[model samples]
Target chain A: MSLHKKILIVILVASAGAFLWMEQQQNNFTSGTDGQSASLPHPGHSAPDFTLEQLSGEGLVQLSEAAGNANGAVVYFWTSWCPFCSASMEAVENAHRVHGETIHLIGVNVTSQDSKQAAENFLKKHSITFPNVMDQDGAVADMYYVPPVPAVFFVDSGGTITSRKTGAVTTGELEQEISRLKEAD
Target chain B: MTEPFITWSVGPFTISAQMLFIFIAAAAGYGVMSLYLKKLHVENRGEILGTFLTSLIICAVIYKLWPFILDPQLLISPGNLLYFAGGPYAVYVSAGVAVIYFFLQSIRKKWSHHSLDSFMAAITTALIVFSLGVKNYGLPSPFSFGYMYEGVMYHAVNFYYSWLFLLVLLAALILVPSSKKYARSITMLTGLVIAYGLAAPFQV
Candidate 1:
C-alpha cells in the first residue's frame, strides 16, 4: 500500500478503537458505575454549592439546598447593566411564574459589578418575582465561572448541571430546557 | 485538569476559552486554505477566497438572526442581536447552509476534486482546534489522559478528536501527492465520521 493508504488505515483503526472505548464508557455511565463530576461548574458535573443573601430581602439561599425542587433549579447570573440580561429577564420571570411550583429559579446579581440599589431597581422594574440573590462579593460568580451576564445554568434534582447557556435565552429556549430537565426527572 | 474552561473578564462581560477557540479555528481554517492554494499556485485565488468569505458571512448572518426567527419577541430588544446567537440548532442550520453554498460555488467554479479535497483539509484544521477549545470530554476513565472533574476521571474525548484531526490534516498536507487525487480527503472524512460516532457516547 502507498503512504496515503497506510495513513488512512491508521486513522480508521484509531477511530474504531475510540468508538469501542466510548461504548464501554456509556455502559458505565448508564449503570451508575462511573459518572461523577469534578468541582468545576461545567455541564455533566455537580454544580458547586454556594450561599448568598437574597437581592431584595433578608436571609441567605444555598444552591444545594434548593435542589429539593421536583424539576430542579435554574441558576441565572446577571448584572443590572447588561442589555442582553435585561431582555432575557422577562423570559426568566415568565418561566418562574409558570413553573415556579415545580422548579426553583435562583437569580444571582453580580453585585460586585452593579450596586445593590441598581440591582434592586432593575429587578423591581422588570417585575421579577423569583428568588434573586446578591453575589455581593462575586464569590459565587467566581465559583461558577460565569461568562458574561445573562448566563443561565440548569441543575437537575440530583444536583448535576444538565445544561447551560452563556447569552440571552428566549422564552421558547427556556421552556425547552425546562422540558428536558423535567424529562430527566 | 482542575479548570476545564479558561475565562477572562473584559469590563463586565467575560469571554470563555471556547469562544476564543472558535475565532482561532475560523482564522486557522482560512489561513490553511490560503496556504494550500498558494502551494498549488491556483490562478483563481481571489475568486476562491471570495467564495469562502461569502459562505462565512452567510453562516454568521443566519446564526445571528436565528434567535429572532425562533422567538420574534426577541426583537423587543434589538440589542440582543449583538449578544445572543441562536442555539445548537442554529449552528446546524448555519453549517448546513454553508455546505450547500459551497457545493453551489464549486459547481459554478468547476473546481477539480483535488481542490475540494484541499478545502476539506482546511476544515479539518478548524475542527482540530475547535475540539481542543470545547473540552468535549467523555465518561469516567482510569487513563492518565483523563481529566479529574469533581472526583471522577473522564476521557478527554475532544483531545482524542484533535489528535485524530491533526493526523488527517498532516496526511492531507504531506502524505497525499497530486497523483493520489481524492484518496486522503475521503479517508480523513470517513475516519472523522466514525470517530465522532464512537466518541459521542463518551461526551457529557
Candidate 2:
C-alpha cells in the first residue's frame, strides 16, 4: 500500500477511537449526578469567607462575621446582566423584609461581567433593601465556586454551609432554605 | 486553582489566560514556520508573512461579522453584536477562509511543497500548545489520571489532545516523505477530523 493510503487508514482508526471515547465520556456525564450544581460547594463544607466593599458606600461586609452573628447568612452571587437575577432579587427582597432580623442576607454582585453602576441601578430598580457587596475582581464568586448567576449559599452561624441553590429561587424556597440554615445549629 | 480557566486582573483590565496563551502560541507558530521555510530553501519570506497577516485579518473580520450576518437583529446594538455573535462556528469559518486563501496563493504563485509542509507543521505546533492552555476537560473517570475541576472529575481531554497532536506532528515530520505532493493537506485533514471527533461530545 502507498504511504499516504496507510496514513489515511491510521487516521481513520484514530478518529474512530476518539469518537468512541467521547461517546463514553458523554454517557458518563449524563449518567452521573454532575448536573447544574456540580460546580458549587457542598453542604457541610465551611463557607469561603470574603470581605467585599458594600455597594451602598457602607464599610466592608465580611462573610465570617455575618455568619457568626445572625441565625444564618444567605450569601447570594448574582450579576446585573443575568435576567434570572432580576426576578430572584424580588423573591430575595421579600424574604429579607420578613426575615431581616433573623438572617444575614448579603448579595455579592459579580462585577466581572457587569459594571458597578449597572449593578447599583439594578438594585435601585428592584428596590432591594439588603446590603449588596461589589465583587469587583470576582474573587468571592470564585471562592464559592459559583457557576452561574442567581446562586445562593446558606451558611449556618458557624460558617459551615447548610445548603446551596443554583439559578433562581422562589420566596417559599428561600424561606425554607433560611429556616433549614437556622435549624442546623 | 483546579479549574481549567484563569482570569488575571492587570490594573483596570481583566485578561483571560487562555487568550494570552493563544497569542503566544500564534507568534511561536509563525516563527517556527519562518524557520521551516528557510530550512526548505523557500525564498520570499515576505510573501509568507503577507499571507499570514492577511489570513489573520480575514479570520478576525469573518469571526466578528459572521454572527451579524446570520442575525441582523444583533446589529441594532454594538453590545449585542459583540455578545451574541461568533463562537465555535467562527473558528470553522476562519479555517475555511485560510485554506481557500492558501490554495489560491499556491496556484497563483507556484509555491513549493516544502512551504505547505512548514505551514502544516506550524499549525500542528500551535494547536498542541493551544490545547494545553484551553479548557478541554473530558467526562468524569475513576482513574488516577483524571483531573478534578470545580467539584467534578474529568478525563483531562486537553492533555490527551496535546499528546495526540504531538504524535501527529511527529508523524508529519518523520513518516511523510518531504517530496510528497499534498502531504500537508492530507495530514491537516486527518488531524482536523480526529480533533473534531474528539471534541464533539464536549460541545455545549
Candidate 3:
C-alpha cells in the first residue's frame, strides 16, 4: 500500500477513537448531573431588597432606593481575597466614574470569608470612590443567591433585575450593561 | 503581585493577555525556526513557513471540531462552537498535527535530521515564551518564591518549566556536534524526553 493510503487509514481510525472517547466522557458528566443549582435570581425577576451599612459608616444604603432614584443600579458583590475581584475592581471603578451620574454603582463587600480591614485596604489601594456597603453576616449575599465573588447584578428603576453576570467584569462589559440600563429607562 | 487576568481595549475591540502572548510566541517561534534552518545551510526555508501555516490551520479545525464531537448539543450555533471548543486538548492536537506534517515532509523531501532538530528548538522557544504568560501555577507550597493566585500562594511551576526548556534548547544548540551523524535527532529526542520528565511531577 502507498504511504499516503496508510496515513489516511491511521488518521481515520484515530479520529474515530477520539470521538468515541469524548462522547463517553460527555455521557458520564451528564449522568452525574454536575451538582450545579438552579436557584440563582434569573433576569426579569424582582431583585431582593436589602439595606446594609456603608463601609465609611456614614449611613445605610438601600438597593430599592438607589434603583428608584437613578436610571438603574449595579450591585457588585465582591471579596478582597478573590484574585478575580481585585483584577475586576478597576473596571468597575472606571464604569462608575463614567456612568455614575446616571447609574447608581453600589459595591457590596462579602465580609463573611474576608476581613473588613482587608476590604477597606482593597478600596483604598484601588482608589475606588464609589459607595461600598459591607455585608457583615453575608445574609445579603445569600438573599441574592450569589454563587461567586465579583458578581454584578443590573437592576432597573422598577427594582427588576435586568441581568446577572458572575465572574470578572471588564470595562467594556460594565459599560455595555450600563448602556442597556440607560436604554431601558 | 501578578494580576489574574489582563485585557486592553482598542476602540470597540478588547484584546486579552492570553491572545497577545500567543501571537508573540508564534512570531518568535517562526523567526527562530527560520534562523536555525539558515544556520544549518538549508536552502528551502519556505518549507518551514508552509509547514507552520498548514499546522496552524489543521490545529484550528481540530480545536473547533473536537468539542462538537464530544457533545452534538454544542453544535447549536457558531458562537457556541467558539465558546465551548478550544482548550488544553487543542494544544495536544496541534502538536500531533505538526509531527505528522513534519514526518511526511521528511519522507517526501529527503530532509536531513538536522531540520528536525531546528523544528524542536523552535517549539521549545515558543513554549518557553507561552509559559511566561500562561496561568498554570501548581499546588500550594510553603516556599516564599511562589505566586499568589487567589489569596493563597502556589508553586510557580510554569516558570520552572520555562527555565528548564530554555536550558534544554541551549544544550541542544551548544553540546551537539553538527558534523556527527544522527547528532540532531539524538539531541532533539533527548531534550524532549528530559523536558517532559521534568514536567511530569508538576502536571495537574
Q: Over the stretch A1-185, how does candidate 1's per-residue lDDT look in tens digits?
A: 67767866687577667668757756865686544556557788678888889976768888888866467899999999888898789889999999988889999999988999999899889999999999988888888876467789999888888888888878877898888888888
Q: What does the lDDT come to for candidate 3?
A: 0.70
Residues B22-137 of candidate 1: C-alpha lDDT, one tens digit per residue = 77888898888888777778777767777787887898889888888887776775677786787748889998898789778987888766557656877898898788777764
Stretches > 4 Å off in candidate 3: A1-185, B1-5, B69-84, B148-153, B199-204
Instruction: Give the C-alpha interface root-mean-square deviation per candidate.
Output: 3.7, 11.0, 17.4
Write candidate 3's Cα lDDT for A1-185 as tens digits: 65755654565355446434634543464467642222224355467788999998989999989999999999999998876687668778988998999999999999886789999999999999999999989998877755356778999987877876666665655776788899999
Query: What is the C-alpha local distance difference test score of each model?
Result: 0.78, 0.71, 0.70
- Give the per-residue Cα lDDT of candidate 2 at B142: 41
Candidate 2 residue lDDT tens string, B75-194? 565554433324325568877898688668866888877666777877888888887777555545544565665566666666667766766776666677777886865876597667
- Best-fitting candidate, scored by TM-score: 1
Q: Write the per-residue lDDT of candidate 2 for residues A1-185, one digit (tens) a residue.
A: 67875876587578658658767756775787544323324454467678989999989999889989989899888988886677568778988899889898999999876899999999989999999999888777777655466778888897777776655555656777887877775
Cα lDDT over the full model 2? 0.71
Question: For model 2 chain A, where is the 10-residue window of minimal lDDT?
Answer: A33-42
Assign candidate 1 its CAPRI class: acceptable
Better of 1 and 2 by DockQ: 1
Fraction of native Cα contacts reproduced by each candidate: 0.50, 0.11, 0.00
Error of 3 at B170 (Å): 0.5
Model with the higher lDDT, candidate 1 or 2: 1
